[model samples]
Target: MNVILPTVITAGLFDSLNPCAISVALLFIALLFTLKKDRPFILKIGFFYIISVYLIYYLIGLGLLKAFSLFGATHFITKIAAIVTIIFGLLNIKEYYFPHAPIKLRMTHDARFKISEWAYKASIPATVVMGILVGIFEFPCSGSVYFAIVSLLASKVTYLTGALYLLLYNIMFVLPLVLIFVFATNRVVTEKMINWQERQGRKMHLILAGLMISLGTIMLLLYF
Candidate 1:
Protein backbone atom coordinates (compact mmCIF):
# COMPACT_ATOMS: atom_id res chain seq x y z
CA MET A 1 0.00 0.00 0.00
CA ASN A 2 2.79 2.41 0.84
CA VAL A 3 4.56 1.61 -2.38
CA ILE A 4 1.39 1.89 -4.39
CA LEU A 5 0.49 5.32 -3.02
CA PRO A 6 3.80 6.89 -3.93
CA THR A 7 3.86 5.21 -7.30
CA VAL A 8 0.41 6.46 -8.17
CA ILE A 9 1.16 10.00 -7.04
CA THR A 10 4.49 10.19 -8.83
CA ALA A 11 3.10 8.73 -12.03
CA GLY A 12 0.15 11.11 -12.01
CA LEU A 13 2.32 14.17 -11.47
CA PHE A 14 4.77 13.15 -14.17
CA ASP A 15 1.99 12.37 -16.61
CA SER A 16 0.41 15.75 -15.95
CA LEU A 17 3.52 17.41 -17.35
CA ASN A 18 2.76 15.90 -20.75
CA PRO A 19 3.36 18.21 -23.66
CA CYS A 20 0.39 16.98 -25.64
CA ALA A 21 -2.18 17.96 -23.02
CA ILE A 22 -0.36 21.09 -21.91
CA SER A 23 -0.02 22.39 -25.45
CA VAL A 24 -3.69 21.90 -26.16
CA ALA A 25 -4.60 23.52 -22.85
CA LEU A 26 -2.40 26.51 -23.61
CA LEU A 27 -3.98 26.79 -27.02
CA PHE A 28 -7.41 26.78 -25.46
CA ILE A 29 -6.41 29.56 -23.11
CA ALA A 30 -4.91 31.55 -25.93
CA LEU A 31 -8.02 31.12 -28.04
CA LEU A 32 -10.29 32.27 -25.26
CA PHE A 33 -8.12 35.32 -24.83
CA THR A 34 -8.24 36.01 -28.54
CA LEU A 35 -12.01 35.81 -28.51
CA LYS A 36 -12.00 38.61 -25.91
CA LYS A 37 -13.84 36.46 -23.43
CA ASP A 38 -13.99 37.89 -19.92
CA ARG A 39 -12.16 36.13 -17.10
CA PRO A 40 -15.36 34.76 -15.59
CA PHE A 41 -16.51 33.37 -18.91
CA ILE A 42 -13.10 31.90 -19.54
CA LEU A 43 -13.05 30.34 -16.10
CA LYS A 44 -16.50 28.87 -16.62
CA ILE A 45 -15.53 27.35 -19.93
CA GLY A 46 -12.23 26.15 -18.53
CA PHE A 47 -13.97 24.60 -15.58
CA PHE A 48 -16.24 22.49 -17.70
CA TYR A 49 -13.43 21.57 -20.04
CA ILE A 50 -11.25 20.39 -17.17
CA ILE A 51 -14.17 18.45 -15.75
CA SER A 52 -14.75 16.78 -19.08
CA VAL A 53 -11.12 15.75 -19.21
CA TYR A 54 -11.23 14.39 -15.68
CA LEU A 55 -14.40 12.39 -16.27
CA ILE A 56 -13.29 10.93 -19.55
CA TYR A 57 -9.92 9.91 -18.18
CA TYR A 58 -11.42 8.45 -15.02
CA LEU A 59 -13.94 6.43 -16.97
CA ILE A 60 -11.22 5.14 -19.22
CA GLY A 61 -9.21 4.09 -16.19
CA LEU A 62 -12.24 2.30 -14.81
CA GLY A 63 -12.73 0.46 -18.07
CA LEU A 64 -9.12 -0.63 -18.17
CA LEU A 65 -9.23 -1.78 -14.59
CA LYS A 66 -12.42 -3.75 -15.19
CA ALA A 67 -11.00 -5.34 -18.30
CA PHE A 68 -7.88 -6.45 -16.47
CA SER A 69 -9.91 -7.93 -13.63
CA LEU A 70 -12.24 -9.71 -15.99
CA PHE A 71 -9.44 -11.30 -17.93
CA GLY A 72 -7.81 -12.55 -14.71
CA ALA A 73 -4.43 -11.89 -16.24
CA THR A 74 -3.24 -9.05 -14.10
CA HIS A 75 0.26 -10.53 -13.76
CA PHE A 76 0.61 -11.14 -17.47
CA ILE A 77 -0.77 -7.74 -18.33
CA THR A 78 1.52 -6.08 -15.81
CA LYS A 79 4.54 -7.66 -17.47
CA ILE A 80 3.37 -6.53 -20.88
CA ALA A 81 2.67 -3.06 -19.56
CA ALA A 82 6.17 -2.85 -18.12
CA ILE A 83 7.72 -3.72 -21.46
CA VAL A 84 5.47 -1.33 -23.33
CA THR A 85 6.32 1.43 -20.90
CA ILE A 86 9.99 0.89 -21.61
CA ILE A 87 9.30 1.08 -25.32
CA PHE A 88 7.29 4.25 -24.82
CA GLY A 89 10.17 5.71 -22.85
CA LEU A 90 12.56 4.96 -25.68
CA LEU A 91 10.16 6.55 -28.12
CA ASN A 92 9.95 9.67 -26.00
CA ILE A 93 13.72 9.88 -25.95
CA LYS A 94 13.69 9.52 -29.71
CA GLU A 95 11.19 12.36 -29.93
CA TYR A 96 13.45 14.60 -27.92
CA TYR A 97 16.43 13.85 -30.17
CA PHE A 98 14.72 13.42 -33.52
CA PRO A 99 11.42 15.21 -33.37
CA HIS A 100 10.92 15.00 -37.12
CA ALA A 101 11.21 11.26 -37.16
CA PRO A 102 8.55 9.60 -39.32
CA ILE A 103 7.06 7.93 -36.30
CA LYS A 104 5.94 10.30 -33.56
CA LEU A 105 3.92 10.10 -30.39
CA ARG A 106 1.53 12.97 -30.69
CA MET A 107 -1.98 13.87 -31.58
CA THR A 108 -2.75 13.50 -35.29
CA HIS A 109 -3.15 16.49 -37.58
CA ASP A 110 -6.85 15.80 -37.98
CA ALA A 111 -7.33 15.55 -34.24
CA ARG A 112 -5.51 18.82 -33.69
CA PHE A 113 -7.58 20.49 -36.39
CA LYS A 114 -10.81 19.23 -34.90
CA ILE A 115 -9.76 20.37 -31.46
CA SER A 116 -8.78 23.76 -32.79
CA GLU A 117 -12.08 24.14 -34.59
CA TRP A 118 -14.04 23.41 -31.46
CA ALA A 119 -11.74 25.55 -29.30
CA TYR A 120 -12.36 28.52 -31.57
CA LYS A 121 -16.03 28.34 -30.71
CA ALA A 122 -15.22 29.31 -27.10
CA SER A 123 -18.61 28.18 -25.91
CA ILE A 124 -19.08 26.11 -22.74
CA PRO A 125 -20.44 23.12 -24.62
CA ALA A 126 -17.85 23.46 -27.32
CA THR A 127 -15.08 23.64 -24.77
CA VAL A 128 -16.44 20.52 -23.10
CA VAL A 129 -16.43 18.69 -26.40
CA MET A 130 -12.95 19.94 -27.14
CA GLY A 131 -11.81 18.73 -23.76
CA ILE A 132 -13.21 15.32 -24.54
CA LEU A 133 -11.31 15.34 -27.79
CA VAL A 134 -8.13 16.32 -26.01
CA GLY A 135 -8.61 13.59 -23.47
CA ILE A 136 -9.04 10.99 -26.18
CA PHE A 137 -6.42 12.19 -28.63
CA GLU A 138 -3.73 13.05 -26.11
CA PHE A 139 -3.71 9.47 -24.87
CA PRO A 140 -1.23 8.13 -27.36
CA CYS A 141 1.40 10.58 -26.20
CA SER A 142 0.52 10.81 -22.51
CA GLY A 143 -0.95 7.45 -21.50
CA SER A 144 2.10 5.35 -20.71
CA VAL A 145 2.25 6.37 -17.06
CA TYR A 146 -1.44 5.79 -16.73
CA PHE A 147 -1.28 2.38 -18.37
CA ALA A 148 1.53 1.29 -16.07
CA ILE A 149 -0.19 2.65 -12.97
CA VAL A 150 -3.45 0.95 -13.85
CA SER A 151 -1.67 -2.32 -14.44
CA LEU A 152 0.06 -2.01 -11.08
CA LEU A 153 -3.25 -1.39 -9.39
CA ALA A 154 -4.83 -4.39 -11.04
CA SER A 155 -2.05 -6.60 -9.82
CA LYS A 156 -1.82 -5.20 -6.30
CA VAL A 157 -5.32 -4.13 -5.26
CA THR A 158 -8.99 -4.97 -5.46
CA TYR A 159 -11.31 -3.27 -7.93
CA LEU A 160 -12.89 -0.89 -5.40
CA THR A 161 -9.55 0.08 -3.90
CA GLY A 162 -8.03 0.56 -7.31
CA ALA A 163 -10.96 2.77 -8.22
CA LEU A 164 -10.21 5.01 -5.24
CA TYR A 165 -6.56 5.21 -6.25
CA LEU A 166 -7.68 6.06 -9.75
CA LEU A 167 -9.58 8.96 -8.30
CA LEU A 168 -6.44 10.17 -6.52
CA TYR A 169 -4.24 9.58 -9.53
CA ASN A 170 -6.55 11.49 -11.84
CA ILE A 171 -6.98 14.36 -9.45
CA MET A 172 -3.22 14.69 -9.37
CA PHE A 173 -3.15 14.36 -13.13
CA VAL A 174 -5.45 17.36 -13.57
CA LEU A 175 -3.94 19.54 -10.87
CA PRO A 176 -1.55 21.26 -13.22
CA LEU A 177 -4.30 22.01 -15.71
CA VAL A 178 -6.33 23.58 -12.94
CA LEU A 179 -3.39 25.70 -11.88
CA ILE A 180 -2.65 26.69 -15.47
CA PHE A 181 -6.23 27.69 -16.13
CA VAL A 182 -6.38 29.82 -13.03
CA PHE A 183 -3.09 31.59 -13.65
CA ALA A 184 -3.71 31.97 -17.36
CA THR A 185 -6.62 34.23 -16.66
CA ASN A 186 -4.02 36.97 -17.04
CA ARG A 187 -2.98 37.53 -20.62
CA VAL A 188 0.64 38.32 -19.84
CA VAL A 189 0.93 35.24 -17.67
CA THR A 190 -0.69 33.17 -20.39
CA GLU A 191 1.78 34.39 -22.98
CA LYS A 192 4.73 33.69 -20.75
CA MET A 193 3.43 30.21 -20.04
CA ILE A 194 3.04 29.56 -23.71
CA ASN A 195 6.60 30.63 -24.28
CA TRP A 196 7.86 28.54 -21.40
CA GLN A 197 6.09 25.47 -22.68
CA GLU A 198 7.57 25.92 -26.14
CA ARG A 199 11.07 26.22 -24.75
CA GLN A 200 10.73 23.24 -22.43
CA GLY A 201 8.65 20.98 -24.63
CA ARG A 202 11.38 18.62 -25.67
CA LYS A 203 12.80 18.63 -22.19
CA MET A 204 9.44 17.45 -20.95
CA HIS A 205 9.70 14.48 -23.26
CA LEU A 206 13.16 13.72 -21.98
CA ILE A 207 11.97 13.83 -18.40
CA LEU A 208 9.08 11.51 -19.15
CA ALA A 209 11.47 9.20 -20.93
CA GLY A 210 13.70 8.87 -17.90
CA LEU A 211 10.80 8.41 -15.49
CA MET A 212 9.04 5.85 -17.64
CA ILE A 213 12.21 3.84 -18.20
CA SER A 214 13.02 3.83 -14.48
CA LEU A 215 9.48 2.87 -13.54
CA GLY A 216 9.37 0.14 -16.14
CA THR A 217 12.67 -1.25 -14.97
CA ILE A 218 11.53 -1.22 -11.37
CA MET A 219 8.24 -2.89 -12.22
CA LEU A 220 10.01 -5.64 -14.12
CA LEU A 221 12.46 -6.25 -11.30
CA LEU A 222 9.84 -6.30 -8.56
CA TYR A 223 7.03 -8.16 -10.26
CA PHE A 224 8.28 -10.02 -13.30
Candidate 2:
Protein backbone atom coordinates (compact mmCIF):
# COMPACT_ATOMS: atom_id res chain seq x y z
CA MET A 1 0.00 0.00 0.00
CA ASN A 2 2.76 2.36 0.93
CA VAL A 3 4.69 1.57 -2.20
CA ILE A 4 1.66 1.93 -4.41
CA LEU A 5 0.77 5.39 -3.09
CA PRO A 6 4.25 6.76 -3.67
CA THR A 7 4.47 5.19 -7.12
CA VAL A 8 1.12 6.62 -8.11
CA ILE A 9 2.11 10.05 -6.76
CA THR A 10 5.37 10.00 -8.70
CA ALA A 11 3.62 9.00 -11.88
CA GLY A 12 1.03 11.69 -11.26
CA LEU A 13 3.74 14.34 -10.87
CA PHE A 14 5.27 13.32 -14.19
CA ASP A 15 1.90 13.22 -15.89
CA SER A 16 1.08 16.62 -14.45
CA LEU A 17 4.28 18.02 -15.94
CA ASN A 18 3.24 16.74 -19.34
CA PRO A 19 3.52 19.55 -21.89
CA CYS A 20 0.44 18.37 -23.71
CA ALA A 21 -1.69 18.98 -20.63
CA ILE A 22 -0.01 22.31 -19.99
CA SER A 23 -0.64 23.49 -23.54
CA VAL A 24 -4.30 22.71 -23.26
CA ALA A 25 -4.62 24.56 -19.97
CA LEU A 26 -2.82 27.53 -21.49
CA LEU A 27 -5.23 27.52 -24.39
CA PHE A 28 -8.17 27.39 -22.02
CA ILE A 29 -6.80 30.28 -20.04
CA ALA A 30 -6.36 32.23 -23.24
CA LEU A 31 -9.91 31.46 -24.20
CA LEU A 32 -11.23 32.60 -20.86
CA PHE A 33 -9.18 35.74 -21.12
CA THR A 34 -10.73 36.54 -24.44
CA LEU A 35 -14.23 36.08 -23.13
CA LYS A 36 -13.80 38.13 -19.95
CA LYS A 37 -10.64 39.58 -18.54
CA ASP A 38 -12.03 39.78 -15.01
CA ARG A 39 -10.50 37.53 -12.42
CA PRO A 40 -13.78 36.21 -11.03
CA PHE A 41 -15.14 34.98 -14.35
CA ILE A 42 -11.89 33.38 -15.33
CA LEU A 43 -11.47 31.85 -11.91
CA LYS A 44 -14.99 30.50 -11.86
CA ILE A 45 -14.80 28.93 -15.29
CA GLY A 46 -11.28 27.66 -14.80
CA PHE A 47 -12.16 26.11 -11.46
CA PHE A 48 -15.10 24.26 -12.93
CA TYR A 49 -13.01 23.12 -15.86
CA ILE A 50 -10.33 21.73 -13.60
CA ILE A 51 -12.93 19.98 -11.49
CA SER A 52 -14.44 18.39 -14.54
CA VAL A 53 -11.09 17.18 -15.76
CA TYR A 54 -10.22 15.81 -12.36
CA LEU A 55 -13.50 13.92 -11.90
CA ILE A 56 -13.51 12.48 -15.39
CA TYR A 57 -9.89 11.40 -15.24
CA TYR A 58 -10.48 9.73 -11.92
CA LEU A 59 -13.41 7.78 -13.27
CA ILE A 60 -11.40 6.79 -16.30
CA GLY A 61 -8.62 5.54 -14.04
CA LEU A 62 -11.10 3.50 -12.09
CA GLY A 63 -12.46 2.04 -15.28
CA LEU A 64 -8.98 1.17 -16.51
CA LEU A 65 -8.08 -0.38 -13.20
CA LYS A 66 -11.22 -2.46 -13.25
CA ALA A 67 -10.59 -3.57 -16.81
CA PHE A 68 -6.96 -4.40 -16.19
CA SER A 69 -7.88 -6.22 -13.00
CA LEU A 70 -9.89 -8.63 -15.09
CA PHE A 71 -6.70 -9.73 -16.73
CA GLY A 72 -5.82 -11.53 -13.48
CA ALA A 73 -2.45 -10.03 -12.74
CA THR A 74 -0.76 -11.88 -15.54
CA HIS A 75 2.90 -11.46 -16.31
CA PHE A 76 1.98 -11.32 -19.98
CA ILE A 77 -0.17 -8.24 -19.45
CA THR A 78 2.67 -6.46 -17.69
CA LYS A 79 5.02 -7.36 -20.50
CA ILE A 80 2.61 -6.08 -23.08
CA ALA A 81 2.05 -2.84 -21.17
CA ALA A 82 5.80 -2.40 -20.79
CA ILE A 83 6.28 -2.85 -24.51
CA VAL A 84 3.57 -0.35 -25.33
CA THR A 85 5.04 2.19 -22.94
CA ILE A 86 8.43 1.83 -24.60
CA ILE A 87 6.90 2.36 -28.01
CA PHE A 88 5.20 5.54 -26.82
CA GLY A 89 8.44 6.65 -25.19
CA LEU A 90 10.39 6.12 -28.37
CA LEU A 91 7.76 7.98 -30.36
CA ASN A 92 7.99 10.93 -27.96
CA ILE A 93 11.78 10.90 -28.31
CA LYS A 94 11.41 10.97 -32.06
CA GLU A 95 9.39 14.16 -31.68
CA TYR A 96 12.61 15.92 -30.65
CA TYR A 97 13.95 15.38 -34.17
CA PHE A 98 10.68 15.65 -36.03
CA PRO A 99 8.70 18.10 -33.99
CA HIS A 100 6.12 18.59 -36.68
CA ALA A 101 5.40 14.90 -36.94
CA PRO A 102 1.67 14.35 -37.00
CA ILE A 103 2.19 11.32 -34.79
CA LYS A 104 2.98 13.14 -31.59
CA LEU A 105 0.09 12.75 -29.16
CA ARG A 106 -2.13 15.80 -29.62
CA MET A 107 -5.72 16.80 -29.91
CA THR A 108 -7.19 16.54 -33.34
CA HIS A 109 -8.30 19.77 -34.95
CA ASP A 110 -11.87 18.65 -34.60
CA ALA A 111 -11.47 18.08 -30.89
CA ARG A 112 -9.95 21.51 -30.35
CA PHE A 113 -12.72 23.08 -32.36
CA LYS A 114 -15.33 21.32 -30.31
CA ILE A 115 -13.76 22.48 -27.09
CA SER A 116 -13.67 26.00 -28.41
CA GLU A 117 -17.28 25.77 -29.39
CA TRP A 118 -18.13 24.72 -25.86
CA ALA A 119 -16.26 27.73 -24.52
CA TYR A 120 -18.28 29.95 -26.80
CA LYS A 121 -21.39 29.02 -24.90
CA ALA A 122 -20.11 31.13 -22.04
CA SER A 123 -21.83 29.10 -19.35
CA ILE A 124 -20.46 27.26 -16.33
CA PRO A 125 -21.91 23.96 -17.52
CA ALA A 126 -20.34 24.48 -20.89
CA THR A 127 -16.94 24.92 -19.31
CA VAL A 128 -17.40 21.64 -17.52
CA VAL A 129 -18.30 19.95 -20.75
CA MET A 130 -15.29 21.46 -22.41
CA GLY A 131 -13.14 20.13 -19.64
CA ILE A 132 -14.55 16.65 -20.11
CA LEU A 133 -13.86 16.87 -23.82
CA VAL A 134 -10.36 18.10 -23.19
CA GLY A 135 -9.70 15.19 -20.88
CA ILE A 136 -10.82 12.79 -23.54
CA PHE A 137 -8.74 14.53 -26.16
CA GLU A 138 -5.72 14.44 -23.91
CA PHE A 139 -5.94 10.70 -23.41
CA PRO A 140 -3.44 9.96 -26.11
CA CYS A 141 -0.83 12.29 -24.71
CA SER A 142 -1.31 11.32 -21.07
CA GLY A 143 -2.26 7.68 -21.37
CA SER A 144 1.14 6.14 -20.82
CA VAL A 145 1.71 7.24 -17.26
CA TYR A 146 -1.93 6.62 -16.41
CA PHE A 147 -1.84 3.14 -17.85
CA ALA A 148 1.41 2.20 -16.21
CA ILE A 149 0.26 3.32 -12.79
CA VAL A 150 -3.15 1.72 -13.14
CA SER A 151 -1.66 -1.52 -14.34
CA LEU A 152 0.55 -1.64 -11.32
CA LEU A 153 -2.40 -0.93 -9.09
CA ALA A 154 -4.45 -3.67 -10.70
CA SER A 155 -1.80 -6.20 -9.94
CA LYS A 156 -0.72 -5.04 -6.56
CA VAL A 157 -3.37 -3.01 -4.79
CA THR A 158 -6.97 -3.04 -3.64
CA TYR A 159 -9.69 -1.20 -5.49
CA LEU A 160 -10.19 1.28 -2.67
CA THR A 161 -6.50 1.94 -2.42
CA GLY A 162 -6.26 2.31 -6.16
CA ALA A 163 -9.13 4.76 -6.10
CA LEU A 164 -7.49 6.78 -3.35
CA TYR A 165 -4.25 6.88 -5.24
CA LEU A 166 -6.16 7.95 -8.32
CA LEU A 167 -7.69 10.80 -6.38
CA LEU A 168 -4.23 11.93 -5.32
CA TYR A 169 -2.87 11.50 -8.83
CA ASN A 170 -5.62 13.57 -10.41
CA ILE A 171 -5.25 16.31 -7.79
CA MET A 172 -1.59 16.48 -8.73
CA PHE A 173 -2.43 16.41 -12.42
CA VAL A 174 -4.67 19.44 -12.16
CA LEU A 175 -2.38 21.44 -9.92
CA PRO A 176 -0.75 23.07 -12.92
CA LEU A 177 -4.08 24.12 -14.30
CA VAL A 178 -4.95 25.70 -10.97
CA LEU A 179 -1.64 27.49 -10.86
CA ILE A 180 -2.04 28.71 -14.43
CA PHE A 181 -5.45 30.08 -13.66
CA VAL A 182 -4.21 31.77 -10.51
CA PHE A 183 -1.27 33.31 -12.29
CA ALA A 184 -3.27 34.42 -15.27
CA THR A 185 -5.82 36.07 -13.03
CA ASN A 186 -3.06 37.90 -11.25
CA ARG A 187 -1.56 39.09 -14.56
CA VAL A 188 1.46 36.90 -14.06
CA VAL A 189 1.02 34.49 -16.94
CA THR A 190 2.04 36.51 -19.91
CA GLU A 191 3.29 35.92 -23.43
CA LYS A 192 6.55 34.99 -21.80
CA MET A 193 5.03 31.85 -20.30
CA ILE A 194 3.83 30.80 -23.69
CA ASN A 195 7.15 31.60 -25.28
CA TRP A 196 9.04 29.72 -22.64
CA GLN A 197 6.91 26.69 -23.15
CA GLU A 198 7.57 26.86 -26.86
CA ARG A 199 11.28 27.11 -26.34
CA GLN A 200 11.30 24.29 -23.84
CA GLY A 201 8.83 22.11 -25.72
CA ARG A 202 11.51 19.90 -27.16
CA LYS A 203 13.18 19.46 -23.81
CA MET A 204 9.87 18.52 -22.17
CA HIS A 205 9.34 15.92 -24.83
CA LEU A 206 12.78 14.50 -24.16
CA ILE A 207 12.04 14.35 -20.45
CA LEU A 208 8.70 12.66 -21.00
CA ALA A 209 10.34 10.21 -23.36
CA GLY A 210 13.03 9.37 -20.88
CA LEU A 211 10.49 8.95 -18.08
CA MET A 212 8.29 6.71 -20.17
CA ILE A 213 11.25 4.63 -21.37
CA SER A 214 12.51 4.25 -17.84
CA LEU A 215 9.03 3.22 -16.64
CA GLY A 216 8.72 0.68 -19.42
CA THR A 217 12.15 -0.73 -18.77
CA ILE A 218 11.37 -1.07 -15.08
CA MET A 219 8.17 -2.93 -15.85
CA LEU A 220 10.09 -5.21 -18.20
CA LEU A 221 12.73 -5.89 -15.63
CA LEU A 222 10.06 -7.18 -13.26
CA TYR A 223 10.03 -10.40 -15.20
CA PHE A 224 13.74 -10.91 -14.72
Could you say which candidate leads in TM-score?
1
The collision pairs in model 2 are: none
What are the RMSDs of all candidates, in order?
0.9, 1.7
Tens digits of per-residue lDDT, candidate 2, 88-190, equal 8898887888978768666778888888899788689998898899888888885887888788777777788778888999998898888887886754564
Q: Per-candidate TM vs. native?
A: 0.98, 0.93
Off by over 4 Å in 2: none
TM-score for candidate 1: 0.98
Error of 1 at 43 (Å): 0.9
How accurate locally, in lDDT, is each candidate? 0.92, 0.80
Please give, for residues 95-205, the per-residue lDDT of candidate 1 as tens digits: 999999998999999999999999988888888899898999999996988998999999999999999999999999999999999999999999999999999899999
> Which residue pairs in model 1 clash with each other?
none
